[model samples]
Every structure is written in structure tokens, then in C-alpha cells.
Target: MSASQALGGPSRCGWVLGPSLDKIIKNVAWRKHSQLVAACKSALDKLDSVVDDPVDPASCTPLYGLSTSDTDFVLQPLIMALDSASPKVVEPALDCSFRLFSLGLIRCEIDTPTPTPSPSPSPNPSSHSHIFRLIDSVCKCGALGDEAIELAVLRVLLSAIRSPYVLVRGDCLVHIVRSCYNVYLGGMNGTNQICAKSVLAQMMIIVFTRVEENSMMVDFKTVSVAELLEFTDRNLNEGSSIQIAQNFLNEIVDVKSKEGIAESKLCLQLEYDNSEKKGEPIDGEPGEGADLSGYSKIREDGFMLFKNLCKLSMKFSSQEHGDDNILLRGKVLSLELLKVIMDNAGPIWRSNERSSVVKSVDTSVNLDNKEDAASDDLCISKPRRSTRIVIPPKRLDSYLWAGRKSREQGKS
Candidate 1:
């Protein structure tokens, strides 16, 4: 049994531990390739199984039981396997590479034992370039592999776009977007072009919705966003690009509106009850509290996006020759204009609401412990918690704001 199995973890019957595996990898030549490939898969499988503890969170302990030197010994052989001409060796190897890459564990940190003295070429490739080649292989898999392989490749590709390393994320986006446009330039593979466009749209939504300013900064220099926008503008009716853009815009507007309300609500009580429990004196008076206009930054950022989207709508509007395209463009244009007007009007409306609600009320008028007593006699009684007010009316302000903005823009 291997060390992993000795520790009561999963392992194959003939599993070899680190030193034996290392000897096999370093000594095995290309002439006797089957043993080398099988050994490589076994090492990867061991690492995979080490990470399969029910006790540990998924992908949380990627290096699990392996030391720095041992990890290098394991991964170096697998990188070598990528050069093999045999599909049998390449397929499983690629799958393992994708698994490790997706978990952000493909690159072993330099602190690991037997560190590379300097960067070297293929057969002794550096970690970064190796990962680049691995993902590149996955992208090319679609041409020869089935839909399952293609989608698995795309899924891993998308995860890379969300990587913590800014450069890595940026490069992944550039590859996908450029590949899509390159297909168009090559004037072949309509299916591949459609696949690329769809993935691009999904990727855009993920970035705009889930990412932060730092990630957005990384994308500013990349051609992906511009290429995707150009593709949409030129082939608006050819694929699902237009609908994707429209849906993305709607989601952004909806999400921004929700955040505005949640983050800028009226504070009913200035002093939180928890501070009183800890016997700490709170600073604020009965009414003076955090600014209700706290959502200014959010509004500003959202408005910038909304403005850019409206510009896109205008561009599409100019090219509308067909009745159907014109109708779709008009609907999107109307929503975009509405987004602008709503953003402008929000602060004014919020200011009025703030002023009206700023007046101080006697704290004593609120529900007290004495009010909960069943008997009239003044005795200690449990405090009744405040009843939450539920407003039943559906919020139609966002919809109305869009309509009003469209009308105003039309008049202007």
C-alpha cells in the first residue's frame, strides 16, 4: 500500500509512493511508453484521491499530503506526457491537467523542494507556460472531441477567467474572444463561431455581475471586450448576441436597483440594541445616523455602464433595416434611456424622502416592557419585539422610470 492508503485514504492496489514513482518517471524512456503513461495517471490519481477527503472542503487542500519536492516529482512527469502522440496518453493527461488547473493547483509554489534553478524549455517547462499550453490543448479539443469534451473544456476556461491572478484571467479572456473573431476572419466553422459567441456572452455576464474594480481594470487593455462588441454590432441578427446583450443590460439594471435599496435603507433606530447589551455607550443621537445617500458610488458606477449600453443601443438602432430588428432595437433603446433617467432621478427622490423622515420622534412612544403586561398593575414584563412592516405594493417605479426617460429623450 502507498502512503495515502496507509493513512486509510483511497488508493489503487499497485500504487507506488513518491520515491518509487520518481524513479519510474525519470528512468522510463519513450520506447516503453505504456508503463510511463500508466504511472503518470496513477500519480495524478493519487493526488486527486488525497484531495477527496470527506472531512476537507472540495479543492481546499490541493497539495494535501505532498511536500514541495514530492509535488514537483509528480507534476514534472505529467507535463512530459503532454508531448506524447498517443491519444490514450493525451486524453487522461489533459483531463487531469484540467482538474488541477481548475482548482488553481497546477502550479506548485517555489518553496517546494528541488526547485528549478532557472527557467527551461519543453520536457522541463516552467509552470506558467505549461498551464497556458494545457488550456490551449483543451481549446483545440473541440475540433476532434465530442460535445462533452468541448463543454468540459469551456467550463474550465470560464473558471480561469475568474482567476485571482489578474494577468492569467486577462489572457484567458483574450484567447477565447480572439479565437471567436479568428474563426470569423478565417470564414469557416460557423458552428465554432456560434459556440465562441455564446461563451463570450456568458463570460461577459459573469464579469459584469460577479467581479470587482480590480478585475475590471485587468480587462481594460484586452481586445476581448471590443471584439465581442464588434461581433454583436456586425452580426446582431446572425446569432444570439443581441438577445444576450439585452439580457445582460436588464440584469445589471435590476441588480443595481436592488443593491441601492438594500444598502441605503432608512435606519429606524440610531443606537443598535447589541451595544446596550455589552454596556457600551453609543455615540449617535436618536435620528442622526449613516447617510441615506451611501449608495452614491454604486449609482455612479452603474450609471457609467448604463450610459455605455445606451450608446450601444443607439449604434444598433442606426443599422435597423428590417421591421423586426427595428422593433427589437427600439425596445432595448427605450430600456437604456429609462436606465439613464432613473439614475438621474433617484438621488432627487431619495433626498426628498430623507428630509421628510428626518424628524425626531420620542423614543418612549415605542413598545415598552410595561405595555406587554397582562395586568394593569406595574410589574416587570417581557419586552415585545417590534413588528416588521411589510409593504404589499409591487415596485413599478423602475418600469415607469424607463418609460418616462424614453419619452423625454424622444422629445429632446
Candidate 2:
């Protein structure tokens, strides 16, 4: 008889732990074991047939009347295989994530349908949280076939911005900002790419817009300062971590204030244009500049926005440790931003360095305000450059600081 008939119907884990099924499950486990490698390689062929569409009603036609938890039960093991390092495991994992994302099962997927709410109170709970988490892990893998992971990550960030519920929506925007700070400050353990100044500028523009939307609807009493600080302490170390939280808070405040948001947006757009025109060959400044006020402002704004997020989570009316809650956002964004700052900052910083020095050199030489030949000779005229790239906010500074830090890393 089949195992289901013989063993008192299908057990919760499905399939009996006999030699054949055990062999199947054991082979797919991701643990780095020398002994099981060859067997797992062969079992990969069966992954699609077994677990590819556990949630798809058409695929599992026999279980049309099955409960949601049962459907998840059948699919969870398949995804668990995704966490494994085996090539076989990664393929199915990525496949599942991609499929889930496409099906509107991920936050990025559902987020598109959600329009920006007015400065109003509204709620829209996603039908499924597992899908969100699954998509999240897949996007975090740092690599994807053909498509860049950054684009995938960006889509996720954008989705959060578009969510309808105040707490949930703010949570998403908060993450984008956290990523921004990570990119700006060198906190991501040298894993992320630093953006071009142009990218950074555009990011600020996006963030400034969202902060205003979120700030208007916020119930500031949701999470208190003490609880937020505790949460921050539990999840993040000081260094760039706490600082990122602070920047987010400031950005929210800036966005809410018409005068503040407007000025920052214009300046951000200008900087973005300049960076794009400058291109990818930023070599480095000849001498250290006296100030870091610009970078600091971005950080401070980021922290403030994040602080408010923390407040919301702790004090939410029915909050019960929703992982997607704003207070939990810092960790997610922190790690994401850290990766960008590590990868993209150096070349960008170098490209701008020469220009900054040349400008300084020109200013110093032309004390008489003459269109002098010497200063003119020193400053080579270059054509204006334009790139269509728009960076998400806080992301720019996160990487910029990383680039600068990497430059000085040798000295330290």
C-alpha cells in the first residue's frame, strides 16, 4: 500500500521517513556535507514537480478544498530547501521566489496596486505575510539571473512606499531610508555598492516626497522613544546603525515641512544631475576638504525618520511584533544599505575628487576675480553629462560615506 494508506493517512510532515523519502529529503538539505552532495544533485530534478506550485490551486487540483495552512505546509519544505547552499537548492529557491513575486505574493508585487494615500487614515492588510518573507529572502541573495538584484530590491522598497496602511506603509518607506543611510555610511560590511552622487541626489528626491505623505498620517504616539531606543539597541550596534536611524527621522521631519522638503528636493536634484554628468571615473580628491556638513545632514535626517518609525511600532493599537512593523525596519535597511556602500562608492568618489580639487585650485588662484589664464589652464572644460538614473533616498549617503571611508581605510 502507499504510505498514506498504510500509515494512518498523510502525516503532517508528509511521506513516511523510510529509506526512499528520507533519501529524497536528506539529499535536498542545504547543510554543507561532503557525504550527501552527490545524492542531492540528483534529487534536484524532482524539485519542480514536487514543490513548485504547492500554493497554485490549479497545480494541486486534488486539494481544492484544502485549508491555507495545509497548502503552506506542503510548500514550506520546498522553500526551506532554498536556504541551503547547494546549487540544486538555490535554483528551486530562486524559482519559487521569482514565481511568488510574479504572482503578487511578495510585498513588491502587491505594493504596486496600492496608491499613495492622502494625509488620511486607512488600512490595507496584505493577504499573506509568508509570501512577503519568502520574496524578501530571495531578493536579499545579492545576485539574480540576468536581472540585477538592485532592481529587485528597489521594487521592494517602492512597493512599501505605495502600501495604503499608515504603519505598514511607513515601515516600507523607513526601510528605503535605512538602506540610504547604509549606502551613505559604510555600515554594510563592504557588501553594497556606493551610488554615484547623481544617484544619491535622486534618492533624496524620492524619499523627501514619501516622508511628507507618511508624516501627515502618522499617529506619533504609537511607539514611545524608550521602546524604540530599546528596540534599536537590541537589533543594531551604534556606529552607522544608530546614525542611520537618526537620518531617517530627520528626513521625515524635512519631508513634512513644506519649506524643508522643497529646498532639499531642489538641491538633491541638482546634485544628482551633476553626479550623472560626471560619469563613473571619479578618481579622488587631492586634499581633504575641511567639512562634512553635507553628509552629516543626510545622516541626521535619516535618523530622525527612523526614530519616528520606531515610535509607531511600539505604540500601534493592535501591534503584535509584526516583522514588517517600522521598528523592525532599521535592521532590514541597515544590512541592505551596507551592501551598496561597500560595492559602489570608491569609483564614484574618485570621479568627483579631481573636480572638487580643481574647483578649489581655481578659486584659490583667481583671488582678483580675473578670468585668469593660469586657473583656466588648470580647469579643463568638459561637456555636460546626463544620466537617467534616479537613486532612492538615504541610499546615496550610505554609499558616499563608505567610499570616503574606504579611501581612508588604508591609513587606519
Tell me, by lDDT, which candidate is best: 1
Residue 56's lDDT in candidate 2: 39
lDDT of each: 0.36, 0.32
* lDDT minimum window of 10 residues, candidate 2: 378-387
List model 1 lDDT by residue over 263-379, tens digit each: 111110111111122222112112344242332222223323333333333333332343454344343333323332332332222244332211111111122323332211111
Q: Which sections of candidate 1 miss by over 4 Å?
A: 2-68, 77-82, 85-89, 101-130, 139-152, 163-173, 179-192, 208-212, 215-412
Give the distance in Å from residue 135's predicted Cα in candidate 2 to where it truly belongs: 5.7
User: Any idea how many clashes model 1 has?
Assistant: 4
- Top model by TM-score, which number? 1
Query: Tens-digit lDDT track for model 2 on 1-412?
Result: 3444422123211222112223435456445543344433433323222322345322212112224444344444434544444544444445434333222222211211235543531122232334344444443443332223433343333333322111122233344444444333332322222221112333433333333232312222111222233322233343454344344233322322111233223333333223212112221224333232323222223334433332332233122443433323433333222223223232322244432422322222211212332222111112232111112223333333344356457437
